[model samples]
Target chain A: MNPAPRSLTMDALQFSGTVTAAFSHDFKNTLAIIKENTGLLVDLLAMAEKGRPLDPQRLATLAERIGRQVQRADRMTAELNRFAHSADLPEAQTDLGAMLEMAVVLSARPANLKRVGLEAVTAPPLWIATFPFGLQQLLYRCIALLLDRAGSGGRIVLEADDGRPPVALRVIARTAEDRIPAGETAPTPTPEMTGLAHALQIRLDWDAAAGGWRLTWRDVET
Target chain B: MSERILIVDDETDFLEVMAERMTHRGVHVATAPSAQEALRQVEAGSFDAVILDLKMPEVDGLETLKAIKARQPEAQVILLSGQATLQDGIAAMKLGALDFLEKPADMNVLMEKIRKAQARKMLVVERRAEEKVKKIVSSRGW
Candidate 1:
């Protein structure tokens, strides 16, 4: 599909609200885990005070878990803040690499556990003139959903080729979506991605054949 | 008579451990799996204290605290969890919780805390009984 007339801009309120709500939910859940870990640390300290031998393994695991959760929460809040700031202008010339970095950092836990490899295959930094919030939402959802479907003991390959002509992503999953539990829904991708795609007048292609997913959009020479 | 104490949590293994440990230490222990069931048990029995886990799928520790305190103001409550969130600790304390204990709790330490809370409950009951006596005597009703 041909891109929209470069004359229009995305709305500010819609972009900010979408990112904020997603981050806040994730942060709230993280806060709950942090609270629990802190309390456990307090209990561990008390146990040690009475001359009871502490289990070094358990303590180390607790420390690692606490550190992971804290890092996760920090990254989520940071991304939310960045996404919030980008709402000032629509169709800004932005560095997609930085946004991808933020997304990768935010998904460290799941990505690490999934053993998924994300590679930036672009030769130089790909600067796209697009709505930042919309792009972030789109990429986040796509990556997160692929990760979720990858299962606990699985691997997925993600690559971004933001080359000069057309931009595309190749996602190769080691597991099938049918493997995911029926009760849990993969995190919903925001409408901003679809909206931006609509505004760009480009078809956002999603196909999961040959054991993977592909997203591609040919760059429209301005 | 054994000092009556209530234990509420969803995890069966932990519940069994706590109940068995507390029972072995000469405290009368009763167990419930959910906050709703806990309140039901509270209304049905005379107890000295309660042990609650903070995060449950249906109802959490904070809601349980309010319900338990409202049902039996004299019953001492100690929140328990492996993942006890900070908000849960503060909320439990503000709502008159006696203590918040983390999971995989040391049996001896938990017993000591429970005993102290139980002692406080005994004192409150005694003081209320004394006041009742004083009111009757002063009114010349007895």
Candidate 2:
């Protein structure tokens, strides 16, 4: 493959890997919680064996807690399932809000590490035709860049402007301190971001006044 | 005296469950929902072992480990990560963590690690005591 193509391929793989790692971590934590709960139940049984009366209500609540965790794990895996299949097609009709939602969830692990909040605000649903994986990569890069600039104790609120035809996204950093560094017109995009943005055909505009980032896609076949 | 273990994780379910299980095993266990709380707990009471979750919202596991070791040099730390990489494990070990274990960890394995951590803590405490005794003896020329 050509160098550019290879580089883009690697970028895609890296994006997928990052998301998978976060998802796997979440899944493991979920299982850990469940395992601990089950172990607690076993302990309770052991206590009962030792002539300590087992509260029927406590047993019921424990069972319910385990059930709740099972459901939580099921939802997480379902989101992960959809995320895994995002690249099944090179391009598809994708919901703008859902896409951003996935980006928020996947990038949350790192955002939390930096003490930055990443939230997907409610937006009117709009479907657009584009490369799902490429768009995801672009969003991921944008969020990563935002976090880097935001530093610790910052928040990035993401919402879509549905009034517009292209449905532009507004990723606003809640704190003014996280705004673009002094004298910098915009946040610098990493090489991967440049490559993915070029491939996906999207534009990023830094609004210093708004203290956030805005992404506009004009080639959408809505 | 029974072993006093401190469990720290953001997930309440995990912390509650782990605390209950360890308590049932006759180990005196305390739980912290966040690294900050864990730091406070460590300052308030010395523990034989600290089981810290790697990923947290504000203060991460590495930072927490550093703080704990600073406050209590003899304290033994065992890090737990849901998806720990080799590099993560190496970093934790270099930071003086007794061990790094992946999440959904086997109970038997964890119990064994806790025992080892307790032993390591004892050795560290004893070594410090010995140094203090030597210092005193030298100061008295005895």
Candidate 2 structure, TM-score to reference: 0.91
TM-score of each: 0.44, 0.91
lDDT of each: 0.66, 0.84
For each candidate in turn, the interface RMSD (Å) is: 10.1, 1.5
Worst 10 residues of 2 chain B by lDDT: B17-26
lDDT of candidate 1 over A1-222, digit per residue (tens): 966533224433443454454455456556545555655666667768988778899778667867887897787776667766665676787775676665554454346435554544333566767766666555555666776566645555556665645666554555543342334433333455556667654556555353444556555542
Candidate 1 regions with alpha-carbon error over 4 angstroms? A1-222
* Deviation (Å) of A192 in candidate 2: 1.8
Candidate 2: lDDT of A120? 88
- Give one digit per residue, the lDDT tens place, for model 2 in A130-219: 788788788877787777566677777788886466758887765446544344457776777777766777777777877667777866
Per-residue CA lDDT of model 2 for B26-136, tens digit only, reads 789999988889999999998999999999976889999999999998899999999899998999999999999999998889888888888888888899999999999
Model 2 lDDT at residue B41:
99
Best of the candidates, DockQ: 2
Supply the global lDDT for candidate 2: 0.84
How high is the DockQ of candidate 1?
0.05
- Which has the greatest lDDT? 2
